[model samples]
Target: MTLAKGCTLCYQGAKMVLFVTGRCRRSCWYCPLSSERKGKDVVFANERRIEAPEEAVSLAERMSALGTGITGGEPLLCIDRVNEYSKALKDHFGKEHHIHLYTAQAPTKPELEQLAGLVDEIRLHPPRECWDHITDTDYIASAKNAKEMGFDIGIEVPALPGLELLIPALPYLDFLNINELEWGETNAGEMRERGHELADGVHNAVSGARDWADELLNHGKVHWCASSFKDSVQLRERLKRIAENTARPFDEVTDDGTIVYGVLDLHPGTRDAVVARCRTFLTEDEFSDCGDRVETAWWLLEEYRDRIPGKKSVVERYPDGGMVVEVTPL
Candidate 1:
């Protein structure tokens, strides 16, 4: 399948996201980090806060990840931490497990050399001011250094007006990724200050952001990632991959990668009786005890809802992590 250049693993739902640290050197006005993570020096594996490297590896295993993408406020700032985690992942998953990192800093030769040993790809995000004349910035030297070191070097930047100037650096890069500029809870005020408004009916993306991608298509190795694709495709595919591995037998995996099941809330007084009656109706493999409630196939609960004693509802949750998406009463 033809995937976006330099984003093949992400497109295939085989890349685990490793958020190393949220500390960065530069403050970009359009940064979309959530308030909890924006300036905090926290680490996360997907949405789960992590305190140890083993947790990251366990998450990758949960989703059967073929590779990892390390990102942060600036990964190079915690070079030792990056090296430690990258090596830990490589050691656990083997050298064939591809690892890529995103950084805003223009790293030095020695820094690049150390990173190159653990990473398969390096995507640099130069500051927005340098987008108008990228070749003149210090990024050019860093890109060249990374390329000479045999890393798959690329540039990734939000698609904004005047980004076409980056075409000059293409000869030195293996690819260029243009991400549709987005609005978020943390950046909404700043985005509006920059004269950006949300597109009609769209939730978090700026208007006219896509047009910038269109303007850069004629340049070779340019990949424009639409905001819709990230929500509707990349995320859903990753959820499906995780669901296939983690979903309980009683849960149904929906086409959109949400887990659908029935939950019967149990009170302390009736818990044992209700569970015993439920067991008689459902096969052992078709139901599971979930501490606060019992989960079973939605249809089965729907058919037997009136007979059961406790409040009954069908629940839908994101497959990768158990975040509720929807709940419906019988």
Candidate 2:
């Protein structure tokens, strides 16, 4: 299934997003990713790991993705991999497969020149959180340089209430994609201490950021995105889309760190073996017609909880003789 164009990122299932490496220059307290990037080898996608270009293309093919986005601890931090990923995708998927990037780095002319042929767009993120650290000119210069360097230039940042003092400093930017700040694995306590509380039914994300984005949209000073809200909404309305888009079935991951889908399958005379030993769940509730395929009925198996194979392996029928069902929804 092709990703819908409404999504500014991953609109077309482009797993082209490469978390080149997890090493950032700054550490914002509200950072959702936490310290996971510091010298870590996690090329984190949206609840996914992108290891190699081949695997990426495989996943994309499964999802029927049309493009790719590369971001990270700062894509420029690992320029070689950035070059590698960009070149590989453009080469593999062709140039029409939109490739975009996000970076906090201020690349020089030579660096931007190097990336010009490789990247179609560059989203500069000179964060507003650490005003004491990075400079205003640097953000503008980076945005200006990126535009000059043949990249679709824009700025991306969290829409913090404190940013009112900082937005005008970045007029050179073509677009400012301000995301709603949400608490995640990266900065739970920091956000709590800052008095960023949940907006009622909302989970980890605070309401202040919503007010922040609405104010920006009202003023029309910049093009901002409350992406977290959109993403949260997508989890439900887009379920059929998710099921249809999935190359291989995967569960969703909620903000509370819960895996929404859990399935397990066992082989052969588990009908006899599992049923005989099965204590708690009734046989009829567990399986209406148990075959090689695992139906929702089979997921009700309360017996042999420790012995059930993962769903993936059972679907693929790996040599290990047990199915493996992973519980992660993106």
Candidate 3:
């Protein structure tokens, strides 16, 4: 089956996740947003929080994004921000830079009109309750109207038991994405109370999620996104893209997409001596004196472990100074 334009970019690790805001009006039982963003008002381009559209543009450029997927608690809730960032990305990246947006709310004609040229695709989320009676809701009109205005329209929802109920609404959509439902920090208690469990111990996917939507796999427009694929493949590919664009000369980009480098935690008296020693043995590009610590290639530190007079270790972390993944003491 052909993937939607946005999904195609995402599968290639060429799509940036532009999180506009975390404020939403509805509380769906399966909402997997993390506690840090579930109800908070914040914006993030990938993992970096930002205060301006320019920041999002910069982040997108770093990873050479071919497209962007604007998402949030409900992006429509902050229409102004959505429009601003979408315009900024398109403006900087050119008209060919595709953009797709996800909104739980059924946008009115005015809202759809506002997003006309800025967004190329719209994925509607009609809430599970409205799936069986989608024709009776505003989503049908929204999808039809969006299509008329040049937007590729589709419906995306977490895989749930009543998925078949959405069959009647498929004709109004360009595609239907069935995302593997998974547990989240904010929804774990609720999921447990509802008797939901992980499909396996290693993945966050809900049990029976794929089986619920298995019958629709043969449909040409149906795309199934497994939770494990999102957690591993998607995330790893995205990280690899970022690491390719941002890794330092001394950093070793690992197969898993994390960068590994040597670090020397400087002591008050040994800071200068350590910096001086690093300069003598390492070229200017090979070592960096980052205030309280000195950084170099992990192999260099491993060879000169006895020569440096400070706490030494090798760290593997996400690119662009993201979260630390591992630290091995030397």
Candidate 4:
């Protein structure tokens, strides 16, 4: 029911997602990146696309972020970018701003050493083919290297069948994260080809994925993240956290982390009259002029709808970022 430390911060909206790049050396069949991101060299801070490192910092400030998780198609491939952003966050927020990284690459000592001063944790994803015998891969050396260089080292992999091989290597790791296999727009075909199917009533999770995680929980170091938990708990909590920090005076934060507000679309000629009317009838704290529309609390607008002109709606949108979730036309 609860997430790991890094993931828990993420769920609480304290951890910002810093996607440095989408170029990876390994081709994991179950990667859930969307078509716009997979195999492409793009940078995103949560849902906002960005061109510079400072944009991520600005976005983090907007959400009152306490930490960041550096992810990518393969972050190590873009080591310089990782170094830049990681150092930037720590510089701006101070060292207590927890930062972690996810990579499939078995980085060298120099690369890890560069990250040690900025990154607090390093999670390695060895190829799925090596899941049955993790000790045989370069991940062992990389994990030990990360540990020695003062990073909280751990292994993160899909909770696929025959993952018991990773158990033997747990002694050298600080923690182990097993993610439930998932199907997405970009990886659906590959998932089906590998004999995975959606769990009944669950939209994207691979069937029987949770069962694979059960066999490993006795190890104490293992953290099993069910697909449902990621979709429902983690995402919602993050949204709520952002909503609390970023909601405008006229916006109402919902229990689910969405913001609910009333919008009145005004004609170019009638905008002046509407503004005058709003100013006369509503208190300064109750309304805001949002370019082409007037925004106010849903309940306040509903209480005085008869006095307001033009097409009106109660809109619910994702908190802090993302798009509109619902609009009730009035």
- Highest lDDT among the candidates is held by which one? 3
TM-score of each: 0.96, 0.69, 0.98, 0.95
Residue range 51-97, candidate 4, lDDT tens digits: 99899999888778899999989998888899899888999999989
Instruction: Score each candidate by Cα lDDT.
Output: 0.86, 0.56, 0.92, 0.85
Q: Which order, best to worst by lDDT?
A: 3, 1, 4, 2
Q: Which ten residues in a row have the lowest lDDT in candidate 3?
A: 268-277
lDDT of 3 by residue, 1-330 (tens): 889999998988889999998999999998999988888899999999899999999999888899999999999999999999999999999999999999999999999989989999999998988877888899999998998889999999999998988888889999999999999898999999989998899989999889999888889999999988887888888889999999999999998889999999998877888798888889999988899999999999999988878888999999989999999998
Q: What lDDT tens digits, residue by residue, belong to model 1 across residues 34-123?
A: 888877899998778998889999998988988899999888889998999899999999988899999998878999878877998888
- Model 1: lDDT of residue 179: 89
User: TM-score of the candidate numbered 1?
Assistant: 0.96
The clash number for model 3 is 0
Task: Report the lDDT tens digits of candidate 2 across residue range 1-330.
Answer: 121132344432333345677777777666676465654757753445667767665544543445667776767778888888678767877877677777877677888888888877777777565544434557667767777766777666786876555556545655656777776866768777888776656565567776666645644436555555455553323322333444222333334222233334546755455434433343443432344434332234333346544442212211111123343311
Candidate ranking (TM-score, best to worst): 3, 1, 4, 2
RMSD values for the candidates in order, in angstroms, are 1.7, 7.9, 0.8, 1.8
Total clashing residue pairs per candidate?
0, 16, 0, 0
**How does residue 187 of candidate 3 score in lDDT?**
90
Off by over 4 Å in 1: 1-6
